[model samples]
Target: MSEHGGDRARAEAWLGQDPDPETRAELRALLDDPAALADRFGAKLEFGTAGLRGELGAGPNRMNRVTVMRAAAGLASVLTSRDDLRESSGGVSVVIGYDARHKSDVFAEDSAAVLTGAGVTVHLMPRPLPTPVLAYAVRHLGCAAGIMVTASHNPPRDNGYKVYWEDGAQIIPPLDQEISTAIDAVGRVDELPRGTDWRVLDEAVVEAYLRSLARLPLGTARDLTAAYTPLHGVGGAVLAQAFAWCGFPEPDVVAEQAAPDPDFPTVAFPNPEEPGAMDLALALGKGRDLVIANDPDADRCAVAAGGRMLTGDEVGGLLAEYVLRHTDGSDRLVATTIVSSSLLRAIAAEHGVRYAETLTGFKWIMKAGTDRDRLVYGYEEALGYSVGGDDGVPVHDKDGIGTALMVAAMAASAKESGGTLLDLLDDQARRYGLHATAQLSVRVEDLSVIADAMARLRESPPGELAGRTVTEVDDLAEGLDGLPPADVVRLRLSDGGRVIVRPSGTEPKLKCYLEVVVPVTSSPEEARTRATGDLTALREAVADALGL
Candidate 1:
């Protein structure tokens, strides 16, 4: 059969099997369009190291009810086989949560049904909630597994399913691969069992999550009058309540993006990292102490204070210092992703704490922390932070709501010290030297184009970047410092500048992260000029290497 014909056949089979008329009609519509069919059924959605994520549509390659059910079945199988999990939970149990994205609830339900049919007990959250809450629920409820349906900050058309183990962290290594194997074992959706015994989650579980937020160290309620925006995602209710629980004054909501809307009508993309995602919040926050925002799924956070929005690196730096100062001992360990700013390392070193750098994801950091009990905090450059120890507090996963509350507490404490967050940042720079980080992304319509660019750069590496000699080249794909292999390349410059080039695992773009360090005595004007010049040179070299 022709490729298009095969696609049509597959889509038609799905439509015929679908019980929902609405979904069947949508699938049929795609069947008639060659391009749509190819996009939908070109391949089965691969469960990568990051779990399952893709555009929502009626194809094997998409994140639809059928695909979600398959993933859940696979996860259930993995959970059932684990002796430790079975003994703890009595039976294999999985907690599922979802966001307000299109079809997210339906997908979550589908996963629950699949797990139920597999003889695994299922607890479904009563309504859409933050990703962190689901992460917390996994450990709090003592379930064998957990699932969250969200695309996080991806575009409106996208959705995802992330699986977490009993520890409330995203599945890592052997488990991820084992689940993928089980998912691949089932050849047809009809082969899976169907059941209806999945239970709606207990109200107490969610209540407990809220109660935990109340214990964070906010100094006083009077010092926190802030602005908040959920970016038309699922964070509003949980985050607002968390702030209130922490004794923070009610925040002024950005009316436009206050509610959970799958379409994300007010923003181009539901990501706080995107330009203009915080415009409404910034406008509404004019006179407030700070502006806090969460992405679609509420797993990441962004903060703006004193009329300036801080980058993820800036926030990470501040949080790292705050957590360190709060700790009494010097034996703490601080961890960050390799792509993040190295200023945290300087702070750790100054405090006589150990600093560790993981590969690019929070999963690695979480695992590293689990292996070492000394870990106090871990953060990535993408606005994800795990405060306290990996096994403590809300969850091991990245949590925006919890982090925001902590920020409020820090702000309140800073006020008591007769200074501001900016003042603390300045002090950090004075002690650690000045470290500034920036990233440049090159977008492309076709993913293969990015693959070609990576191939070209690897075949012929650049000798210099931004007029600085490349002092060393570390091909992460070959393994670095006893770490697992990853698809990344790091270029160390002769000056205290470095560049990291890697393709985004979850998106269709190439990312270039640049970090430059200047003496603390240098004026801000001089430091910025030097960084900009270095960035421009690096950009040119990247373009040349990619032949773009």
Candidate 2:
């Protein structure tokens, strides 16, 4: 048989066994169309550290009932095989949550049934909720595992299944590899188990998460109006409830993108970081004290205040200062991704706290916190943040809802003192020179192309970037600063700026993070323009080096 023929055969076989008539019919329709079949069955959907995520279709390469069931069965098998997990709980317990994506609820139910059939306990969220709520439930319910059915800012046709360990963070290294191996071992869709008691999750889990967020030492609450947008995702209602409970004025909602919609009609991508994602919110939010936006699943947040969208670095720096000041100089540490600006390190030093940098994912942040007993707060350049000690009740995963509430509290307190978030930021800049950060992403058609680019760069790295001498180059894969090996390269520049480049593990893109810190003067606007110009030059040099 030809490669395409074999793929069709496999897909047809799975569809033949699928119990859902609708799914089966969908598969049959695709099978008759050569182009559709080729696209659907081109390859098996990869189970990476982020688990399965792609457009939904009737092939192994897409997210569908069969693929979701297979991933659940694999997770069940891996959990059962683990001595620690099996001994702690006679059968594994998994809490599943879904968003407003197409078939998200169906996929969540499918995962529950498969796990239940494997003799595991299944708790399903009763309604569509943010991904962080599910992460909180895993720890609150004392479950051994968790799964969130979401695509999180991807286009309408895409969906995803993200797995989490009991700790509430995305699965890392060995566990991810083990789950992938188990998933690959399943030869047929029928190999998965079926039918077990799946109950709706209890309501207390959500309340517990909110209570935890309220524990942050907010100096004082003051009346401050704000605007919020969920980007047509699943975060609106619950986040509103959180703000209300925390004593902040109800936020003005961006009507167009207020409700959950799989189609995400208003934005090209549902992500708040996208260029125009917050345009609607900004348009509706004139004269507001703040504007807060959460990604589809609410695991990340972006804030706009004082007619400016705060960069993730600026947000991290402000949050670090708030947490450290509230803690009153205790031995706590602030953690950030390596690609993030080093402004936090300077802030930490002034506050007499430690600052550590991990790889460019929350997984690394969680692991770093777990290893050190002093993880007060953690953040990434991608708008993900985790507040609370590592040993806290909430899981280590980022929670945008939680972060929003914290920010509101901080904002309210600042309002009482006649200050703004920007004021706090300016103080930090004055204390620790002005640090400006920016990122450039080069999307590609294939993952292998990125790997090839990395290999080529390693073979012969450029001696200079943007006409500045390269002071030093460090291969992160060789263990930098006692950290684990990662596929990244850092270049220190003669102008005291730095550039870090790495292929995104979860997406088909190569990302470049550039940062330059210059001394602040009376004319802050001039400094910002100069720093931005330098960053633009660095981006061009990186593009040239990659031949993009």
Candidate 3:
């Protein structure tokens, strides 16, 4: 049969099983357009460690009810099959949460129905909430698993499903594979049994999560002025409540972007990392002591201070220092991804704390510290931070609300000392030798473009970057320092700079992480200028090497 004929057959089959009439209409609308049909039904959206994330539409290649129901059934199958977990947990249970995204609530409800039908007790969040709340719920309710419906920083047209195991962290390795295998075995979504036995939880869970924030070692300093925006997400009310509960002043919220709007009309992309996403917040925060922004799910945080938007590495370093200062560092662990700045290692050494560098995801970062050492803090370069305070991680995931509180406390303390976050950053630069970091990300319309770029770099590695000789090349695919094999390439420069090139797992982009460290000889400003220049050169050289 012709490819179009095959797509038609698949589309007809999918339309029959798809329960969402909107998606069914979508499929029918594309029936006459072979190209559109091919786009919708050409390939199934792969369910990997990140779970399912794609544009919202009909067919298996998109994020629709059929795809979500299959994934939920697969998750139910995995939970049911895990006799060890079931026995230990007493019963199979799950907590579901969602953000204010298109079809997010629908997906969450459908998932709950599927899990409930499979004899799994489902405790669903009463309304749209942050991802961290659900992560906290998994452990708070003692459930076997948790599911969150969000695309988290993706475009407005996109949505996603994130799965967390009993550990409250995102799934990794065998579990992701196991769930994927079960999803593949799913025959028909319409045939899957769904139950209305799931329970809609009350504000108790949200209150519990907020109460846990009291444990954050934020010193008694509530005299901090700040501007905040949730980027048209569900974090606004919860974050405001968290601030009140934590004794900090309620932040001056950006009214336009405060409410949960699925279309995210203000920003082109609801991600704070994207350029101009924080423009409104920055404008509102012009004279404030600090500015904070959270993505659509509020799992990741971004900060702005001293008339500048702080890089994720900068925030990670600051938070690491703040956390270590408050905690007994003898047994605690601080970790960051391999793509983050090396400054965390230096800070960890100075603080006498264990530090780990994991592969590029929070999945690996959360699993950094052992049961003995326990993860006190973990962060990645994408504005994701998990701060455990002196105790243990309340939310075993990146928590923007908690991080924002810490930032506020830190800013308040610095203010009391006649300094600002910028001054503290200078102090760190002076002590840690100005560890500057930057990223060169290239978004692509074609997946093959990213693949070709990686292949080109791997085939012909750069001999040097930024006038410095390449001292060492570590093809991360071969595994580095006991890390699992990943599609990444790291190059060490003679001047102690480094670059790591890899494809973004969550988005269609090739990302290159660049860092250049310069010792503060004369002043931190001078060192920063030198390091910035070196980073610019390195960025260009990396772009050239990648043939971008």
Screening candidate 3 with a backbone cut-off below 3 angstroms (N, C-alpha, C), the clashing residue pairs are none
- Name the better of 1 and 2 by lDDT: 2
Clashing residue pairs for model 2? none
- Which 10 successive residues of model 2 have the least lDDT summed? 387-396
Higher-TM-score candidate among 1 and 3? 3
TM-scores across all candidates? 0.93, 0.95, 0.97
lDDT of each: 0.81, 0.83, 0.91
lDDT of 1 at 9: 86
lDDT, candidate 3, 104-143, per-residue tens: 9999999999999988999999999999999999999998
- Winner by lDDT between candidate 3 and candidate 2: 3
Specify the highest-TM-score model's number.
Answer: 3
lDDT of 3 at 309: 98
Off by over 4 Å in 1: 86-89, 219-222, 389-393, 445-460, 522-526
Ranking of all predicted structures according to lDDT, beginning with the best and ending with the worst: 3, 2, 1
Estimate, for each residue in 1-548, the C-alpha lDDT of model 1 and write its tens digit.
Answer: 98989888888888765656666778876667888788777777889667998887776788787788778888887878878767763788889999988888898888888889988999999999999999989988888778999888988888999988887888878778899999987656677787898889766877898887665444453576689998998889888777666667778889888889888899887788888888999999897778899888888989988888888888999888877766655456788888999888888877788888888887788776444456677889898987762224456778898888878777777777876676666676667766878887888899888888777767777788767778888888878986788888888887777888889876678998888776667665466576677667677777777777
Identify the candidate with maximal lDDT.
3
